[model samples]
Target: MTEDTAAGNTEAPANPQVKMRVLGQFIRDMSFENVMAQKGIAGDVQPEISVQVNLDAKKRPVEHQFEVSIKLKLTSKAKGMEDVLFLCEIDYCGLFHVEGVPEDQLHPFLLIECPRMLFPFLRRIVSDITRDGGFPPVNLDSIDFVALYRNELMRRQAEQANKTEA
Candidate 1:
């Protein structure tokens, strides 16, 4: 083997390393409706809410680097209301580096670690948005990345199976 290859094989390869560099952060988009929440607070109104979370990651040309983002949407409405009381969306991201690691290890880091790192920031934003809207702070529960990843994998598998069957 060539010296360079030999060196790489001998010592851990200088894996491409990625470090999240927060370029810029802003409220990409946000909306809050306190009027609905206020109306629902009393017995006259009953409140119902639905929340959806989505995770996505992309690799940058920067070697061993990736951008992982989480998007959340929350909708709150009254029992029989056609109107929404609260509708909010949050998009948060973080950069990560992966070097000297196998693909198996890197996969989890991108899917799990990157999101975990971004969660606190995303959570804070959600809390602030609700608080500013005159409602109690909405604190999101910690997520289990492993479980989330597994579910995603299963969902994709099922979808692929359906496609093949069809």
Candidate 2:
């Protein structure tokens, strides 16, 4: 084969390869202090949980990758009053296969795709937890992870720029 032909045949490595496996998943932390919540709300109450999602990624020494997640805080409050019923902080993570990936392309996949893949499971857990806690099942609205990721990146860049100028 000619050198030029050979060079043309070569393809760029796939970025952010995912060899995703559910390594081990459990309630990393759980609290069901329903008694206090019930006492706090002595009548029929509708509860709501506000969620904030965060995504982080890191490469391993070998081919593996880590997606560290903080699903933000979920605070359940009564429908009428401003009192909080319960609060939960769920921190979860996943191990991913990230091989044959270019350095430049890795960040987007980690920030966008990885979280998109993991969000459904996390959402299910939250819903189940709320239901089991005797409140109505909490169904969270779907998130636009790409937008969230881009905003976060922009915010970080702005912060860094401000710091540099300071």
Candidate 3:
């Protein structure tokens, strides 16, 4: 029996351990529309806000640099009515320097890890924009990137299955 096998260290040594750095971040686009003020709707009310997030990643022209971004769309409405208080959409992005991640796993890493780093800044931006646009600040809830990634994968699989069945 081989000594290495008996020692139970069967796995190959990992080369070029994972490395990542946030090179930079920026707001790609942002828009805030104050629907209530524009429509002249005013009343003491509670707001129901719905937030949607989408993530994207792409390789930059520079080697080892990638851009990862998240677009957040928030629609706020007065409670128990069809009145829109405000609509906000922001695309926030980060440039990352990454190395050592396997090619097969890069997509998930970009979509998940990069966005996790960018979300807090997005939350703060949302809060400020809401406050500035004359509504109470909207603090976003924490996002589960792992679950999101899994759900997206499942959705894509389902889409492929449907295409095949059709």
Give per-model TM-scores.
Answer: 0.73, 0.77, 0.91
TM-score of 1: 0.73
Best by lDDT: 3
Look at candidate 2 and tell me the lDDT of residue 47: 73
Query: Which scores greater on TM-score, model 1 or model 3?
Result: 3
| Candidate 1 off by > 4 Å | 1-28, 33-46, 79-83
Per-residue lDDT tens digits for candidate 1, residues 29-138, read 56666767555655455557788888888888988777787878888777787666677777777766656556777777778877877788888889899888866678
> Model 3, which residues run further than 4 Å from truth?
1-11
**Model 3: residue 20 alpha-carbon error in angstroms:** 0.7
| lDDT values for all models | 0.75, 0.69, 0.93
Candidate 2 residue lDDT tens string, 1-166: 8675678967655555444554444445556456436676566777766776776676666555555464556787777768787776777666666555566767887777776777788789878877887777777788898899889989999999999999
Pitting candidate 2 against candidate 3, the one with the higher lDDT is 3
Q: Best-fitting candidate, measured by TM-score?
A: 3
What 10-residue stretch in candidate 1 is worst by lDDT? 18-27
